[model samples]
Target chain A: MAYQFDFAPVLQHSDLLLTGAAFTLALTAVGAVLGIGLGIVGALCRAWKISPFDRLFGLYVEVIRNTPFLVQLFFIFFGLPSLGVKMTEWHAAVLAMVINLGAYSTEIIRAGIQATPRGQIEAASSLALTRLQTFRHVVLRPALTRVWPALVSQVIIVMLGSSVCSQIAAEELTFAANFIQSRNFRAFETYFVTTAMYFVMALLIRQLLMRLGQRFIVGRPR
Target chain B: MSLVKITGLHKHFGANHVLKGIDLEVAQGDVVALIGRSGSGKSTLLRTINGLETIDKGELVVDGAALHDGKGDLRALRQKVGMVFQQFNLFPHLTAGQNVMLAPTVVKSTSKREAEDIAKEMLLKVGLSDKFNSFPDQLSGGQQQRVAIARALAMKPKVLLCDEITSALDPELVNEVLAVVRQLASEGMTLIMVTHEMRFARDVGNKLIFMHQGRIHESGDPKTVFAAPQTPELAGFIGAVQEA
Candidate 1:
């Protein structure tokens, strides 16, 4: 017996799959914005050595980085309710994604900041700029320009990682695939269609981010 | 009063004492040159004056304000004291004119328009009016140093500290930067420079200090210092440079 590829069963639930795809994209969009915000804060904190705050943030990064994303999602969704704080599945998924992405972004951005030369810092100091002014005007811009490509790739990785949120029953693409497979008894066909949709989604996201990176980060006509 | 004074300055980095018991004085508008071999602490002393290097034990006064004590108003002292470095530390992301205008706009609270005008004037003084809009990398080493000079001058500092400003430039480019320094000195801008160019030090400096082993080995009129160095170390250093 040969493996038969049939689309009719999966095509019947296209609306459900489309809704799931939209939810996945929405989660990624929100998570990326929040994650990048956290990343910038974490990067600056680590770079600036903001005392106890930086130490605490360093611990947060280590914890998030060391553990699996699935465990992190379960902890936020299942574990937090025991502490009298409850969150919806979507909220927990987004939060977990933000935390995970934030840590990775921090490391990437920290490398960028460190790669800035000492000569540049000395030059800024010679201009009689205060430490804060030097960081804002001199150190930050060049560092960001240097690592923006890496940052974009990390963000796309974070987007793909959102599929892991299906474990928390977040109703994203993977969850929708699971639901359609059970309903139609067509696991292979359902997954095949969802996998193709995911490919398209990832490609669209990568293209969009590339355009954005060129517009804002590179800041040159292309 | 001397515009700048250093007495018994000592600085150590871990076990390495970079500057040991350095003493010097500069009257207003004096063009003083500090010449010495590498690792002789000439640059360290210059950096100490600008608070880039903290002194282990010393007193440095610039325009009657204490530099080493850490009690003197740093921003005020820095506002009156400008420095140009060997690397031509212009902000690479900014245009030449903006680089010149930064300190004035930020510290002096000069309006952007006024700051631009001042930057333009300084750029013209450095003979780089045409390159005002250019980036630092776009200019030659000589032109970049000129822009650095203009950036320093835009603050209208009473004293300008130069640390080996021409050391990184090509032989041909050296003269262009020295000419700008000489012009600034001629215009009565007080200049204290750490440099290796023997001829420029001999010709341009009103006073010369030759350092060896983190100490001022000799200090006098440039002609006297170059013609007849007082110490054996100075003699050996001059001899080595001459042979090189």
Candidate 2:
């Protein structure tokens, strides 16, 4: 017996895949924004070594980076509810993705921050700029420019990795693919289409981020 | 009272003591020159005055404030003392005018327009009125150092410190920067300079201090220090420079 190709069932439920992709993109977008916020704070915590808080933040980054994202998702979705912090599957997935991305971005941004020259910091100090002013004008701007390419690639990877959220029934693209496959018994066709959709989404996001980076950062060499 | 005073200053970077019990004083509006061979602690002494280098043991009083005793406000102390580095450490991202304007805007809380006006005036004084919009990389090294000087002066600091301000420039460019310093001294800007340029030291300095092995070997009027240095170390150091 040979496998029969079927397009009718898969095409009929195209709306389901589209909705799933919308959810996936939403999750990635929200997660990325939250992740970048957390990453900047974490990088500053590690960079400034601002007392006990810095060491505590370092521990948080280490644990997040070393563990698998799947396990982290399970901890947020399953483990947290038992501790009286109940969350929806979507919330859990988004939170988990944000935490994972934050850890990686912290290292990337910290490297950028450290790469700034000591002379620059001294000059800022001689100007008598307050700590906050120096960091905003001298350290953060240059650091962000230096690590922008790395940050973009990390965001794209997060977008692709969001497929893993389907394991928790988050109703994203991968979850929709599973549903379509089961209904039509057309596993290969459904998966193939879904994979192509993800590729296109990732490519679009990468291009957009690259354009943003070029416009804001590429020309401003400090 | 001395405008700036250092008494029993001591600093060590690990086992190498960079400043060993340095004592000096500068009256207001005085132009003092520190002359020494490399590694003789001339630069270290300058840095210590501004608290850029922490002292292991000492007292540094600037304009009646104790900088090393931990009793003074360091930020306020720095506002009173402006320093120009050998590398002309201007913020590369900012224009020359912006570089000069930054301290006033941020530290003194001057209005941006007022800061710009002051920056323009300082740039003009440094003979760089045409390079206000120029970045550090856009200017020649001599021009960059002049901007660095203007950047320091924009704070209206009572004291100006120069650490080999012309050492990194080309021979042709050195005179242009030295001229700016000379003009500042002529206007009574209260200057302390570390320099290898013996002729400029002799001409512009009211007082001269010679350092050898992390200590001031001799100090006096420019004529007395340069013509007949009292210490053997000072004489030997000057002899080596002359021979070179």
Top DockQ hit? 2
Reference-based lDDT, residue B178, model 2: 91
Give per-residue CA lDDT, model 1, range A20-128, as digits (tens): 9999999989888898778877888898797887898899889988998888889999999999989899999999989988898888888877888887777667667
**TM-score of predicted structure 1:** 0.92
Chain B TM-score (each prediction, in order): 0.96, 0.96
lDDT of 2 by residue, A137-160 (tens): 778867878898899899888888
Candidate 1: CAPRI quality band: acceptable
Question: A-chain TM-score in candidate 2?
Answer: 0.94
Candidate 1's DockQ is 0.47
The regions of model 2 sitting more than 4 angstroms off are A1-14, A217-222, B68-71
Query: In model 2, what are the clashing residue pairs, if there are any?
Result: none
Most accurate candidate by lDDT: 2
